[model samples]
Target chain A: MPARADATSPWRSVLAPSWSLGRGADPLPTFVWPVASAVLLAAAWSLAAGRFDVTVFPSPLAVAREAMRMAADGTIWEHAGISAARLAAGFAIGGAVAVPVGLAMGLSPFFRRMMEPFTEFFRFIPAIAMVVFALIWFGIGEASKLFLIAYNAFFSIAMATEMGVARVERSRINAVLSLGGSRRDTALLVVLPSVVPYILQGMRIGMGRAFATIVSAEILAANAGLGYLIYSAREFSRMDTVVVAIVALGLLGLAADRAFVAIARRLYRHTLPEEFGP
Target chain B: MIRARFVEMVLPYLLSVAIMLGLWQLAATQVNPLFFPRLETVWRSFWSLASGDLGAQILVSLARILAGFGIASLAAVPIGLLMGTVPAVHRLLGGPVDFFRFIPPIAMIVLAVAWFGASDVAIVFLIGFSTIFIVTINTEAGVLHVVRNRIRAAQMMGAGFWQVFWLVVLPSAIPHALIGMRIAMGAAFSTIVSAEMIAGDYGLGYLLQEARTTLRTGNIFVGIVLLGMLGIMTDRVFRFLIDRFGGEHAGSR
Candidate 1:
């Protein structure tokens, strides 16, 4: 296959370039639109909170105060730190296992045929539904939470890796073989580097899935994470705290996504085309 | 050659299943039954539940997913089209949509419960809210990426704006919209389970949560298996529809 064909892997489309903030066009409206929208939403929310009871919908100001209180007591930091740690651990474990297995499946027809059905079957099973099984097997400890997140990340990353490897140009492999390179050398020098962007894209997607899984897992059973914080606060009708936790979760997700994009760009800058840049 | 190909495809799949089951059986014998029920027992539980309320639970969950996905598609398609075609609207809404999309649906469960309580509305809202963004984004991308020459040709033919959109744009966008729907379906299914597990009295998720509380390892397995089956079934149905009606772009992906 042509080398250009290899660049058209579906994962590239999935990792679409981040929205440009207008190249050389006017920047004022680009800046103003988001600010205006945020102000509008906050005003609407404040009005609704004023019209309704604070118990039902806490105002932005109320949530800010609650956030301040939680920050002062370091509650937000403690929960955020724990949640981040869990996400990091789960993502690392899942990505490490998934990439190699996926590569094997893609490289060997026997392994691919042997594993494809099982992977396809399990991929459909949402990680959230596994919460009960996870609880029963791993209990209400950190292991269960980690298992859930890792399970999510594993499938996503594995799928991407497999696809990436499968899409590697035949000519590239032939070229390497013609050069008298061993299989291991071909894999290390040609296959691995070619799939790095795809793997990074997979990890970014997997990170999002892991974060979502950890939230639900913590909400259902845990004692200390942000999900747990939101759930417990909800039980006590602390809408402000619930709102705070939700906002924190959103911010955390955004930060992680941006960080993943940054790292992917840096690692794959030399390899990927400009259009794929973050 | 045909027979060899058939074996090449089917034999390994069957063997994989057998191996997985064999491993499960072996592990079950070594582990506590309370934590890891025998595969046979789990199969039995699945059979029993299949004959009983498992059907109803599955139906309930499916209905919720369909409802949420349907609503999301209805709202998102037009808006996504508008955003894709109209730069002004895209500019106005893009930032907010981008910001909100990062907020995981699971994180909104508490807020959902607060707003709508532990009822069907809350569950449906969670699923719909979670799904709309994905569908919208996909639909927008679909419209944005429609062949510019096609639109120009239609316009040059004296086709009105509406005619160009209806005849050229909508058809071109269907494949991506269908893909978005598929993605939304998966999102809806998963979100519904999380919502139900957290705060519903019925559905497969509720069954799983209930089984967890009762320490019924067999029932938990049954719930999981049913969910997997349902997920596959829905995915297959979407595939069938896309194959039958998705036009030229049906097989593009």
Candidate 2:
């Protein structure tokens, strides 16, 4: 596939290049449109919020104030930090377990057939729905949250890794074999590198799951995360705080996605073409 | 001796199911029922629920998903077309779309409950929220990917703006729009459970949440297994419909 027009130049703008795809002739710069749009949206939002009681719907300023207060008092860090930790932990556990399983499945048709049923069956069960199961298995501890997030991450990573393994060039594998290289050598040297892009894409998706599950994982659990923050704040109609938490979650998700891509770009150095890769 | 086809194709499925269930049943023998219910007990619970309101509850949730997703598709597709074809609309709405889409639907539950408060509207709104941007963005992508020369060719043949849209533009995007709908529908399905848990008194999500508190592992399994079936069946039906209708263009873009 042809690389995107913007691919040759990285960091052409603050926003990711893909976001600005397919509209090149605009008179305004990229940042101008978003900023202008934000202003327009903020005005509308402010007016709408004023019509409601502030408790029910807060103005953007109110949300900003809440965010600032949370930041100043270190409340935001505590919650965000814990949530990030849980997300990272779940991501690590899921990746560690799924990568090897996916490799096995891709390498051997027998393993794929054996595992396909469970993967297909269980993937349909959304991770949020399993909050109860996680709670039951791990109690109200951190383990429940971790398990729920990790469970969500597991399928995507596994499937992506398996597909990535399938994408390895037949000739490459043949070459390795014809050179009298061992199966382990082909798997480690060739299969592993070729699969990195797919795995990274999977992990990005897994990151999305982790971000989403913050609400489910923190629900009915003890406390101390962004989800808990939202749930707790909602009890008293703390709209500002709720909005704060929601924005934090969105920004966090976006940041996590970009971080994955940036890291992938640095380590793999253009392995991900714009078309197939996320 | 077993036939090669049966051994290779059939055995893995049967064996895997057997092993997974056998291990679960074996482990359940040693654990508290709360942690792990036996397969037989779960089977019985499934029957009990199935014989009762389970079907009706699923229908209720399904109706919400359809209504919500249907409405979302209606609005999103046009807006997406506008974004693709008209630069002004893209500039106006692009930022909000990017910001809103990334905020997962689950995060919206508390606010939805706060605003709509145990109403069907809340659940429907969340379902719509979960899906609208996806459909819109995908539809936009479809439009963007349309070959420019095709539009030029249509114009050269004396096609006007609306004519060109109907003839050249909209048809090409249907497959992508269908793809978006498929994905958004799945998102809608999952969103229903969460929405119902917070807003509705009935539905699989409610049942699951209720069973969680009531400590009915059997009922919980029933909820999960049924949800899986519902998800898979919907996906298959949607794909089949798309393939049947849009066969020529199903995977073109």
lDDT of all predictions: 0.80, 0.81
Model 2: per-residue Cα lDDT over B1-253, one tens digit each = 5799888888998999999999898889977766889999999998999899889988888888888898999999998987776655677788788778778787888888777876888888899898899899888887777777887787788776677678877887777788888878777866887667655688888898888878899999989998999998988876876786554655432
Candidate 2 chain B lDDT trough over 10 residues, lowest sum: B244-253
* Model 2 CAPRI rating: acceptable
Kindly report the fnat of each predicted structure, to 2 decimals: 0.59, 0.55
**lDDT over C-alpha atoms for residue B237 of model 2:** 77
Which pairs of residues have clashing backbones in candidate 1? none
User: For model 1, how does the per-residue alpha-carbon lDDT over A105-178 read when each residue is reduced to its tens digit?
Assistant: 98998899999887888888889888877887887899998889889989988988887897788889889999
The C-alpha stretches of model 1 lying farther than 4 A from their native spots are A1-29, A270-278, B244-249
Give chain B TM-scores in order. Answer: 0.95, 0.93
DockQ measured for candidate 1: 0.48
Give the Cα-based TM-score of candidate 1 against the true structure: 0.91
Restricting to chain A, the TM-score for each candidate equals 0.86, 0.87
Task: Report the CA-based lDDT of candidate 1 relative to the real structure.
Answer: 0.80
Q: Tell me the spans in candidate 2 whose CA falls farther than 4 Å from its real position.
A: A1-25, A268-270, A273-278, B245-253
- For residues B18-38, what per-residue lDDT tens digits would candidate 1 score against the true structure? 998888888889877776789
